[model samples]
Target: MLTSPVDDEPPLTGKMQPTNVVVLGASGSIGEASLDVLSHLPPKRWQAWGVSAHRQLGELSQRLFATGLRPRFIVASDPDSASMAQGMPWPKGSELLFGGDALVDLATHPQCDTLIAAIVGRAGLESTLAAVQAGKRVGLANKEALVVGGCLVCEARQVSGAELIPVDSEHSAIFQCIQGSSSPPRSLILTASGGPFRTSTGEQMRQASVADALAHPTWQMGRKISIDSATMMNKALEIIEARWLFDVPPSKIQVMIHPQSVIHSMVEFVDGSVLAQLSPPDMRLPVQYAITYPERLECPVSRLDTLSRYDWEMLPADPERFPALTLGFEVAAAGGTAGAVLNAANEAAVQLFLDGEIRFTEIVPACRSALENHHFEQHPTLQRLLEVDRWARAEVQRWHSGTRA
Candidate 1:
């Protein structure tokens, strides 16, 4: 009948193909949401090429069996060094890789077209670099990769022609706003939820418990990230991430306190026009965008209703109140070994604080001490970075324990 639409279309049965993808940190919040999105994608749109987790073999196995999508490779970043004869296990046809080097190797695997860098903290740095060096389209959820080695990451991206797409909601919003603009914007305005302690005074923060800190008002996230939000350390780290991702200076990136988290981020053009992306506070929306770059795929997350009257406010972040914010910008501007040390120190301190070993205020102080004591090494090679990361961890532990002793 009138040359049917199906007849006119090319045969998709054998033609259209999905990109091969890897999900690093596949057991985390972002990873879970990513899997949800991947499960929904059309067969011709995307495929899960590999999956990785730190140490969740049972959970990982169940997830793989449920999806019926066995990756060619699965990585367990944690391994028992004492049992050298133990075999890494996965689905019958899949291979299991172990340890940090295995993570890097899997990231740069020849079949990987896109890498979802969701591994948290500084542990993500090497794998992220490996992905970049291999010229894979990187869905960068790992902020520490940029935080600890922004210059190196930026350089790698340039050298290998890898595209770094932002997966964080704030960064994702700014990314969308920048896409339509004629040129680079005058400033990138990242929105902060002010966390659960937005209204709490500095004295209140001192008395804040882990339970208080973890009770995020808007978004669901991991323990470490929740604590980062409480101290506004998340915003601080985003400052560094935005610096490298956008190739903008810390001065050009601004943070606004938006307690509702309705407006993820905004971009101010040179002519005074501000473009912002507003959506419901959901990680899936941003995760979807990262997965399908240059294409706006359909997702379940909702958009803000512009017709309704909504209150939105912007305020300067007080660095004195949240020293974590200052330390973030300081490390970003300092460059070299500072990011490695700051990240490692904060990771240790955050864990200690979570364990109720230190006061909330001590988090920033411990990080500051670590940064100060760090031996400056210019042009840090990968080996040097690893050394500094280990050194910072030891130093933070020593200080934390000595203070208690």
Candidate 2:
């Protein structure tokens, strides 16, 4: 059963003092935006405890120095023994630590009141789980963590009093929509821009190149993610993520195509009322929301002006056009290790397609094939999830080699 840390809401009231924060994946898109949000906050209350980046040590150091708040720790996930964190003075006895493992250490640091799990992909899983286990309030942008090990992470949150606020714009919208509603939502509708090729035929999709796939219509993201968006696989993975995040079954979750990308998500109650969260497509808005929940900020990234002249339309997602969504709902319904295997296979297949080794259409097929053939572990442990992830990656490799050559 899904659980919420209701017994540990910390009273939800005060002068709203800023908490000491550690930002994992400090060089990524969400991380950079988080730094911007942090910069806007009252400095005396808020402190940047640490920043961790995959390999952008120089850039990370520059950002830290520019903030003028020396961090207690700085980490580089790359292992050249590079120490950009060194020489940045800390208050009194504060220390600077460098190295790959420092990411995990700082994530669960004793002094950090909040940790932003913005690291993308499976690389972020361990650090995110560590922060949750340590009971730090985690703003989770890393959906793959929940995708791979939602049950385990949910269990950890129950035990550790960690607050896992959804940072993805769609999930964040759903989170906001469900707040204070008297009735349980009958359905949750997640909106999608359908990426760049929402209407492309199967034949056209088979011919789609990486450049074509990465041309996302509504949002700017990294290459890997943009490609995932094009295939609609990102939304597929999100279905599974949302299932765990909201504790709702797959049957209650719905995906709708909203090409304008204005309405992020909506919740329909049994009383026939729908609560929708609408906003301009900006990651900072959701990032700010996650940081300052239960309070509205005076400044926002962007707002939707309903009175302003705008053309909008919502359409039922055509399963014939996008098979990934169907595959997502199916895998999510399957539960157990299927989520892990599906995500791992999609990750691998996306990489192969991006490398020009597979067609865009093949991404979903590869994932479906992996999901169908894999042996599902009924009750999965963390080790079991990892094992399934590993096996799926290998399965994708075998499929790629056989088909590509």
Candidate 3:
């Protein structure tokens, strides 16, 4: 969770000039951690230029109070939930913007040097693409953006010379290890904590309750992602993210259930040397890394105790027990619209499972059905990808609601 560990304390030598930051999902777990990192830095070094919340104003307000930083701009995507943010305590001169397009406006603002695209799901796509197109350094934690529109995001970055620093712990580890390497990696190994049901048998998993699935073992995460972790579907989406982020074939990516959650990820080179990034499972480390990318700073998170006895272990994931692992590789191999359908279907299915509309075991099967039922395109346009995304969500709903797919 703490991205990669830094060996030395970063020099705090100068009166840091402010670097404008816009956090898209200011209320979410990742966004809040990012804010925490910003607060630790000298105010001159970095500042919260803008922040957005979908709902959760009370939590956002607390975060603002803790940081002692009032962002210049704020957006609330939920219209009715917040008719206006004007009534809240502010440091004065802060502009409160509304509606969906406000995300794009804030992301692509001339003053915004860094964009934290932490908004979850495909809903974050439009603003994320806007940031990429504007050539801003984007700290991407929204798995759906890459999973649903990997081509669009990568292609836009290539054309615009924008830097996409992955914020997810696993991808961040891979990013740090592969830096300045001469040769390409042989494969990428993403570590999974195995969630709460990591050791459960197939029969036992089928009977898991929502409360059980939400009880993640190692990390505290959002509800939807928590369930995805239990089902290992989050890793599946990350498989797609790795493909786009590292330019690796699906075969070059592998998943290993590291129950300890100490080793974030590992990269194997052609020479058989394995490069691994290990740290305490703290989300702030990665968020801090992304915020201060290309510059390693001292982290507030704890470092690994080299003197302590270690019982590190990694086991091959049981495909029979956690079938969602197969779906990711399958989607990655298929490419194009397959990723879109799979990501959207999984999102919808996870929500259904959360609502108790569908059972925990039904999540992956619903996603599989959507992918199988949808039309597959090898090279899909953005519009085509979005079309498939909507269809997949609808298909999952129909499948669960007893409508024809």
Candidate 4:
């Protein structure tokens, strides 16, 4: 059984009482965006209480210094980066901690009102789970935490009464649309930008270089995510994430290629009503929404200009071109160690592609091979999931080596 925060504590009433936020993965794109959101939010309503950097301690320190944001605790999750942080000027009065466990410590700390779990990949799973277990309001930007262990995280959230709010633009849009009606949503429609290769031929994609794949059309994102987008694996992963986040069946969730990306997502009701959330491709909007739920504040993100005529297009996603969608739906429906395997395999395969160790087209096949070969478990513990994660990663490596040999 997990413990929760004090029930008797008074709720936030005014701007005078600030919400203390712990942003894990404080050096990543999402982290930087989150920090920007926090900075723009009224100072009395939010504070950067704690932050962590996996290996970008120097950059994190520089960002903090530049922003003049003084967090109470600064964590360097990679122990090797401790020396790099030694010379960097971190904010004054910030106690610097080192190693992965420090992330968990900051997550479950009593003062942390909201935890922004933005660490990329499986490295964030444990701390995100800890925050949920401790009943912290979690702004989950790390989809892998749920993709890898949705059952465990959901179970922890249920037990601790933790609020698992999504920071992903698509999911956040769906979340916003669902809040409008008292009726249950009939289905969720996830929109995709179709990446840089939406119009590229299969042969063209097969010959795509790292530069080609990372050239996203609308959204600016990190390399791993950029590749995932180009391959449509990011949408696939979002499919898995939406399944768990909305507690909706995979069949009820649909993906459409919206090249313009003005419509983030939509939700259909039983009455044949569809509500869509539309905005420019800005991450700060969703990040800010996750931080302040049930309340809308003035945001720094650019507003969608209604005066300009727009050409918005939504097309059916072709799973034949992007096999990763098939894998995502399969993993979501399987609901066990399958998700762990798929996430780990994709992460490994993406890294391989980035390293030029694998072809652009090999990423999905590699994930599929691992998912198909792994042992299926209907119910798995956290340790089992982690073990399966490692096994799947190794399986991808073996697949690569065997393919080259």
Question: Scored by CA lDDT, what does every candidate get?
Answer: 0.84, 0.81, 0.87, 0.90
| Tens digits of per-residue lDDT for model 3, 1-405 | 111122143533454547889999989998888888888876787889889888876678778888887788778778765654656765566667776878898888766789988899999999998899999999989988999989889999999999999999999999999998989999999999999998887778888899899888889898888999999999999999999998999999999999888899999999999999999899999888888988988878889998999999998887777889899999988888999999899989999888878878889999989988987899898889889999999999889878333
TM-score per candidate, in order? Answer: 0.91, 0.90, 0.94, 0.96
Candidate 1 per-residue C-alpha lDDT over 6-27 given as tens digits, one digit per residue, 9 for 90 to 100: 2354533555656878999988
Residue 321, candidate 3: Cα error in Å is 1.3
What lDDT does candidate 4 reach at residue 180?
57
What ranking of all candidate models by TM-score puts the best one first?
4, 3, 1, 2
Backbone steric clashes in candidate 3, count? 4
Off by over 4 Å in 1: 1-15, 65-68, 81-93, 305-308
Q: Which residue pairs collide, candidate 1?
A: none
Q: Please provide, for model 2 over 1-405, each residue's C-alpha lDDT reduced to its tens digit, 9 standing for 90 to 100.
A: 101232243643466655778888877878887887787766666667777877766676666666565566667677653554454433343454556577777877666788888888877888888889989888888898888888888889999989999988899999999898766789999999999898887788889888889888989887777887898888888898899888899999999999998899999999888889988898888887777777777544766786799887888888778888998888778778988898899889988887888888899889988988898886798888888999999999998787767
Q: Number of clashes in every candidate structure?
A: 0, 0, 4, 0
| Residue range with the least summed lDDT across 10 consecutive positions in model 1 | 1-10
> Cα-based RMSD of the predictions, in order?
6.9, 5.3, 6.2, 3.1
Stretch of 10 with least lDDT, candidate 4: 1-10
Evaluate model 4: give its lDDT. Answer: 0.90
Residue pairs in clash, model 3: 1-282, 2-282, 3-286, 16-44
